[model samples]
Target: MSTASRIAIVTGGSRGIGRAVASRLAAAGQDVAVVYASNDKEADAAVGEIEAAGARGIALQADVADEAAVTAAFDTVERRLGPVDVVINAAGVMALQPTRELDLAELDRQLRTNVRGTFVMAKEAARRIRPGGAIVAFSTSITRLRFPTFGAYAATKGAVEALVPILAKELGGRDVTVNAVAPGPTATELFFDGKTQQDIDRIAAMNPMNRLGTPQDIAEVVAFLAGPGRWVNGQVVFANGGAA
Candidate 1:
């Protein structure tokens, strides 16, 4: 493929895997619109990195699930950076609780951010992503492992997994490949947020790699799907190191 620069929208690009993907794409010579829901500072820093990598960087804020906001954010990116050639839907949240005792609010929050947000971004991507463009979404290995407290969280990811293949078919004629990257336990701040060190270690050990995945590991896979992975449509490429 040509090495000409492309434009991309990377949702939740302020930190973690999102940041890594945005930076990687930029390093690969793609102008990146780093979308962040709330953290402008981190978003600005991410954009700076993208620019420093010799690609344009623009920081736009929007809730991935909010229709009007998402539309406007995409519009701004298109206006400033040209039509988006790739979209990485990395904006998501996770909550842990048993099904019976799960907090209704937390469950709704997860559904809104993960399921609805993914659909909203993906539908828009289907509409605007250029031919040969790619759309990458996030799922979770928890969906495979079926751990006790992750039922709700996994359910949302499972929803995305279901959405990907159909969307890939929807975009088949247009050459826009759609896929998801389901990662196993990662060492992001999100993973260790409330866990004890022992808890984190135990979870890391579950992976056959004998260590947790890193944001960069996930980003590398996302980059493949975004650029060179033209033939890999409608697939969920798991990056868990055999944890699941």
Candidate 2:
């Protein structure tokens, strides 16, 4: 892949799906800013991979849920890399708990981080992105599956799916596309932690592919949307491999 002059920002780019998306963009020749919450080490590692792929890379630390921090992060990226040509809102949290046992604080955190943070990043991207740029937000198959303990988390992702069309309309005249990617089960740290072999097997069997999705699996779709698939706007492209 040859690099384009485009610049991209991948929130939560320090690890997992975000990191994969960042690397994909880099492979396509876009300078990438890998944003992380706290760990500069992980962010640096991602940046190194991007540089190795022959694209310029930078690591920025910011809390996606905090408005000021998010604003600063975007501003820094723009200052360093010029106007963002692509924005992938992949920063989110998953909190699992039955409704009766769900703590109010945890519920609030999930909503604030997933829903509000997405909104903040999208709004900022709408304002700052280049005319031909694209924005991709993260949703989850859990929104459709509606698992019992995923009420709050799924609700937040559902809100994101609902926003895609409106955002696409808002950015229409500017030739910017807005979309969301809803991924099913992926073998990320989030899924592996606190899972026994039995739990892992059950989760894997839930997917028709008989295996969990990989971060790269999801990133490939994101790369398409951010590049050639610009015509596909206001859509929630599910990359779950028939899991949902």
Indicate the worst ten consecutive residues by lDDT in candidate 2. Answer: 1-10
Q: Please list the residue runs of candidate 2 whose C-alpha ends up more than 4 Å from where it truly belongs after superposition.
A: 1-3
TM-score of each: 0.98, 0.96
lDDT of 1 at 40: 85
Best by TM-score: 1
**Candidate 2 lDDT, tens digit per residue, 1-244?**
2339899999989999999999999999899999888888899999999999999999988888788898998888889988889999898888789989999999899898899899999988988998788999999998877778888888889899999999999776898989999998899998787779998888888877999899999999999999888689999988877876
Residue pairs of candidate 2 with colliding backbone atoms? 3-29
lDDT of 2: 0.89
Quantify all predictions' global Cα lDDT against the true fold: 0.91, 0.89
